[model samples]
Target: MKEKYLSTRRTYRESVRPHDGEVRFQVAVEQTDLLIVAQEDLRHEIASFVFQVRGEIKNWILFHPEFAESLSPVIVDDGAPEIIRAMAQAAALCDVGPMAAVAGAVAQAVGDFFSPRTPNILVENGGDTYLHSTRERVVALLAEPDSGAVVGLGIEAEAFPVAVCASSATIGHSLSLGAGDLVAVRAQDARLADAAATALCNMLRSEADIASVLERAQILAEFGVEGVFAQYNKKIAAWGNVELVALN
Candidate 1:
């Protein structure tokens, strides 16, 4: 199903600054809006590829309607597309619906498509991201945009080809069952990071839920989640491999 982009200003995009030797561009196909930073401007290619990925997922959902509507994992039939399988498996691991991983999955799929053609790529869809870099990088956190807060997650060069995805009840358009400001997850797979972020965000109904959710993040380490960061109102906490840093 096609979804429309929000007309409201995407202020968080202001934080996506391109580094030296990189180019930044935006691609919007139906509901999938991506901001890409790469070694070269590949907007045309990225747009075509992401459109194809969304088409495949849409066509697959036509046969398996539950794959798009299920709030829990759904097993795809044989001959499912790789992106569909990735979303399904990640959702199963994080106990979230496959759609929860759609943004990150699309972003990573684009990264995968261009990896061999480029040495560095960063794809951000909605707020979830798929990053591959040869040097250190920092991703801005938009937990409370109204408060003028500035913070980010620092990624070491060693964590290349990683996904840092976020879910929030107070930001963007993604659905959430909790009231937390934000919950970000890092994983080797963008789908897994996206699904886990949604799953963890669903567990946070209040600031009191922060400690318990960070503990839960540790358990998720068994399922490819390298780290997690959570914010609820003025409170913030993190666990595992997360490295919080100030952002200008």
Candidate 2:
């Protein structure tokens, strides 16, 4: 799955966010749309940084068009932009295309860019998120748009500076070879979480694939994947540090 929150990005953003009093805002540049929560309103700073980083990525893609179009991992030079290198590394680790990690990588980049200015920050691109905070936050899970969100992951404050990303074959614009409802992955690296979510979602062709997909998530634990939540039809599976909770 590539993009899960395109049509309902705003609604989804509002639902998942904690009511902490932090300033919330949005910035959009072409295909990159971000919902950000920070201790202070840094819309202007974030927008300029996002524009610069996107331009760097675009320029590199122009020189190497295959990097953007490949369905498999591609190597990047030592001098590649930080985002490009992160995507390439994530794709290699998850055995998928670099684009699979684009959303999360961008979110992470933006979050890191302003980390020094704010003690708390959350950057969400589509359904991929990068979070850092001094307090716990709950992120709602929306396996199916029609059902809204019945559950959420309760992340402790200690898990700050983490990434949570989702992918769905049945939900959005992202291409998925599987038939799963949703797959969410958590990790220290947003790029890895994003790519891993996509890779794992591709393994779920039916409800029967849920168990094996969860097993696959366990194997990924060694690679810094903190947790995973998967759903296919009536079956659902979770592994690692995933903390499921009811969402009102």
lDDT of 1: 0.87
List, residue by residue over 130-154, the lDDT tens digit for candidate 2. Answer: 9988888887888867657889888
Point out where model 1 deviates above 4 Å: 1-7, 147-149
TM-score of each: 0.95, 0.94
Candidate with best lDDT:
1
**Each candidate: how many clashes?**
0, 1
lDDT of 1 by residue, 89-184 (tens): 999998989999999899899998898888799998888888888999998877766554388889999888999999988776788888888899
Q: After superposition, how far is residue 182 of candidate 2 from its true place, in Å?
A: 0.3
Mark the regions of model 2 whose C-alpha exceeds 4 Å error after superposition: 1-10, 16-20
